[model samples]
Structures are given as structure tokens and as C-alpha cells.
Target: MRQKLILERTNEIRCELNKVWDITKQYWYPLFECTREDLISFDSNYIMKSKK
Candidate 1:
């Protein structure tokens, strides 16, 4: 029963990850193309700030 519960949670996480991946692909591709460098810079800055 515990194993089954774990499997169900894993599946749910996988589904959510796929949804997020799809949305990121759909929306970010254009922004990525337009400001590839700026996006990279912003992401790096955001990650650094978040770590603090």
C-alpha cells in the first residue's frame, strides 16, 4: 500500500512537470529568441538572488 501511494505521487509529479515543461516551451521560446542573452543574464541574476 505504501508503494502504491508512492507510485501515485510520482505519477502526479510527472504530470505536473510535463504541464510546466509544455507551458515553458510554448511561452518562453519567443522570449528566448528575442532576448537570448538578456534572458540568460536575468536568469543567472534571479538564481543568485534567490540563493541568498
Candidate 2:
């Protein structure tokens, strides 16, 4: 995630990482308290893409 965002944002990776981190914490962090089923939410592929 950090790598992808850094690639996209270039020199702004630090700032972009912070923004994404905050947003992720705000919305998804609480899910950590949930059961594995709930936390799974779909799959890791949601955050990944096919590499060339």
C-alpha cells in the first residue's frame, strides 16, 4: 500500500501516506476488534493489482 501510494504520489508520498493512514484509521481501524470473518471483508486482493 505504501509502495503503491508512493509511486502514485511521487515526492508527496509522505503527505499522501499520512492522509491515507488517517483515513484508513478513521474508517477501518475499528474492524480490528471484529471477528476474523468480519475483518476479512473480501480479500487482500482488494488492495492489490495485477503486475505486469
Candidate 3:
């Protein structure tokens, strides 16, 4: 019963966080738009390396 309640609370927290992120994402900007693409590529490469 306690585990179920914990899971439910966790899900609620995650939903709230997603809502916050959705609002925050709209205001996020980069000095150069291209930098966002570079960061994304770098993140993907890092993720791939870590997966091995």
C-alpha cells in the first residue's frame, strides 16, 4: 500500500515537472540558433558513447 502511494506521488511530481518544463522551454534561447543544434549533436554523441 505504501509503495503504491509512493508511485502515485512520483507520477504526480513528474507530471508537474513536465508542465513546468513545457512553460520554460518556450523562453529558452541561444546566442546563435546553430549552437542549439551543435549541443544536440554533442549530447547524442555522448549518449551513444555511454551506451557502450
Candidate 4:
């Protein structure tokens, strides 16, 4: 019975990790296009130009 409970908890943890992985993939791809330097600071000008 204890082993069954542990297995259920493990499954729950796996499901939660999968959800987080999906969210990370959704947002990470665009940032992957950026140079390492671009992420160093927030730039309002870059954002403004990007909107055009």
C-alpha cells in the first residue's frame, strides 16, 4: 500500500514537470534568437522598434 502511494506521488510529480516544460518551450524559442548581449539589460528602444 505504501509503495502504491509512492508511485501515485511520482506520477503526479512527472505530470507537473511536463506542464512546466511545455510552458518553458512556449516562451524560450523567441529568446533563443537573441544574442547573449541583448539579454543583459532592458531596452525600451529595442522594444519600441520591435513593435513597428
Each model's number of backbone clashes?
0, 0, 0, 0
- Superposed by TM-score, candidate 1 places the C-alpha of residue 7 at a distance from the truth, in angstroms, of 0.2
Candidate 4 colliding pairs? none
Model 4, position 8: C-alpha lDDT score: 80
Tell me the whole-model lDDT of each prediction, alpha carbons only. 0.57, 0.50, 0.54, 0.58
In TM-score terms, candidate 4 sits at: 0.33
- Runs off by more than 4 Å, candidate 4: 1-5, 23-52
My TM-score estimates for the predictions, one after another, are 0.34, 0.23, 0.33, 0.33
* Worst lDDT 10-window in candidate 4: 32-41
Q: Is candidate 1 or candidate 3 better by lDDT?
A: 1
Candidate 3 regions exceeding 4 Å error are 1-5, 23-52
Cα RMSD of all models vs. native, in order, equals 9.0, 12.5, 9.5, 10.5
Of 2 and 3, the candidate ahead on lDDT is 3
- Rank order (by lDDT, best first): 4, 1, 3, 2
lDDT of 3 by residue, 1-52 (tens): 3455588898898779656544244343342233233234236677899999
What's the lDDT of the predicted structure labeled candidate 3?
0.54
Q: What is the lDDT of residue 35 in candidate 1?
A: 28
Best-first order by TM-score: 1, 3, 4, 2
Q: What would the per-residue lDDT of candidate 2 be over residues 1-52, giving only the tens digit for each residue?
A: 3445446477587568545544344344445443333345555575566442
Tens-place lDDT per residue, model 1, 1-52, is 3455588898898779656544345445445444233324246677899999
Candidate 3 lDDT score at position 30: 42
